[model samples]
Target: MLAPGIRVVRGPNWIWQNQDDGEGHVGTLCEIGRSGSTHSPEKTVVVNWDSGHRTNYRVGYQKQYDLIVVDNAQIGVKHPNIICDGCSKPGIAGIRFHCADCSNYDLCATCYGNDIHDLEHSFVRYQTANSVGVRVPPRQGALKIQLKGIFVGARVVRGPDWEWNNQDGGPNKTGRVMEIRGWDNESCR
Candidate 1:
């Protein structure tokens, strides 16, 4: 049932329900590590957590209690194309700043700066829909500056929603556009 790109719902581990050792933590199953030999029945399920921790559990062992594959449709995770709350533009990959208080209130980097949103409201800047590590925008505007070059060594910066790949080059790293490749996220690349 577990597969790559499939988000899993890790249920409460009964053994450690009372303890707070992060045993019942929820995360995505990243990989299925081999058990050395090809005939080996046991395998490791590598789970990458939202808290930035990677833990490996036995496949059969965890599946019985924790780790249920999440159906996006059943869980109401399916969004009908994210439109910028400020500009009303469809598929704005750069939409990063979000109002925690408001329901579904999101703003692109451009609009977040140009428009005067609630000054008292707190904002969380993220690169994608399923990114973790919420933090206030370091400053205003996009996470990275726009560049003209697309080739290697061309100084380019990441936008607010630049987490298309498993890559987060991080903020304020004035690095060149390493690659110009097609990404699955149409809004991003």
Candidate 2:
């Protein structure tokens, strides 16, 4: 149903439609149609992040369609000894990536201040599944997070919140609090 190298924009939170009711659609920026946002004077959403145009929904609401950046994970905590995307030191598992021109290099929190980020990019990490969280069963009140490592080098691009975020914006805009993986409601003996 898809091809490689095709950048896609999807969300369970919102969708685009011919007639808005909060229903979104999937297509390149060239495919979306016109709505109020398509013609709004004060709105300036990026065409790459979100097509600067009109988006319909499931409800009978219509407005300038704006994209929100949120965490990637549904639930989970952070890992320690986190590696820096810049020098790739203090390497650890589960550290998040940082970037300024999100469309550019996949930099990390440590490297956010480095020359890679064109602007004064902010360094933030994600702890949600929507960003880069994983599931862990309750065993000994302990969990060891692992980075989605690659096979090229001892260092890997830390990672980033897989959100449709602005290259250089504020904190997470939206997402939900999901449950911990395999966390029993029962108390420990």
Best by the lDDT measure: 1
Instruction: Record all residue pairs in model 1 with backbone atoms less than 3 Å apart, i.e. clashing.
Output: none
Worst 10 residues of 1 by lDDT: 70-79
Q: Tens-digit lDDT track for model 1 on 52-84?
A: 455555556546444544322212222236677
What TM-score does each of the candidates earn?
0.32, 0.20
**Candidate 2: regions farther than 4 A off:** 1-13, 17-38, 44-189
Give the Cα error of residue 129 in candidate 1, in Å: 25
